[model samples]
Target: MQFHIPAGVGEGMQLTVSGKGNTLGRHGGINCDLLVVIQEEKHPELERDGNDPIYNLNISIPDAILSNTTEIPTAEGRAKIK
Candidate 1:
């Protein structure tokens, strides 16, 4: 499902949309609560440490030996770092 996460939404935050849950017509209630749980997936290149992001960059032997700048992908975009 595609949900537009509002600004300032973080972990353990609850976002409820009315009338979007399971029906309870048998109980004489037209609306039901939809509980959503958020789980973080394992990332191949990045990990989280509290609020900070830790990047695991794998460089080639030549690149690492030569000490070249590498481009890393961030949430904003790509960035070059030494």
Candidate 2:
């Protein structure tokens, strides 16, 4: 899945992700879980909620899963979060 970083993202920044959807076996289903880790420290784990503001900078999806079928663009926004 390709992720497009919005304009104004910077290095060493932190943000929150709200909702994400995934394909269920082959059909569309509920959004997947979001895990954000910074510099090896696991912090800011986000989930799908209607009231949350999905942050932009400090979030990332795996390249393998994203590239497998999704066409989301991948680029360097800041530090790698695993």
Candidate 3:
């Protein structure tokens, strides 16, 4: 089965689907609701803060001294920060 995760869902959040879990009996007993816990996969370039993705910009000493735009990885794509 497939389920969609809504936008801005945070880590450790729980979602329930009605009557999707184990059933009580064979004779028309009610099925338990399915509970899903949300877990965010670690991204190499980003960390999560609440539902927002954060990227710490770290520039080399030469780049910082030269005042050049440094390209860094962001959640959406590569970004340049001076």
Per-residue lDDT of model 2, residues 1-82, tens digit only: 4445454444444544545444345575656644333332222533223333244442246755564332222232333333
lDDT per residue for candidate 1 within 1-82, as digits (tens), equals 5556675455677877667688887866777656665555656677777767788778899998888998997766689987
Q: How do the candidates rank by TM-score, highest first?
A: 3, 1, 2
Clashing pairs in 3: none
lDDT of each: 0.72, 0.40, 0.84
* Model 3 misplaced stretches (Cα beyond 4 Å): 59-70, 76-82
Superposed model 1: Cα runs more than 4 Å off: 6-14, 56-68
Superior by lDDT: candidate 1 or candidate 3 = 3
User: How many clashes in each candidate?
Assistant: 0, 6, 0
- lDDT at 18, model 1: 64
Model 3 accuracy (lDDT, Cα): 0.84
Per-model TM-score versus the true fold? 0.55, 0.22, 0.67
Write down the RMSD of candidate 1 (Cα, Å).
4.7
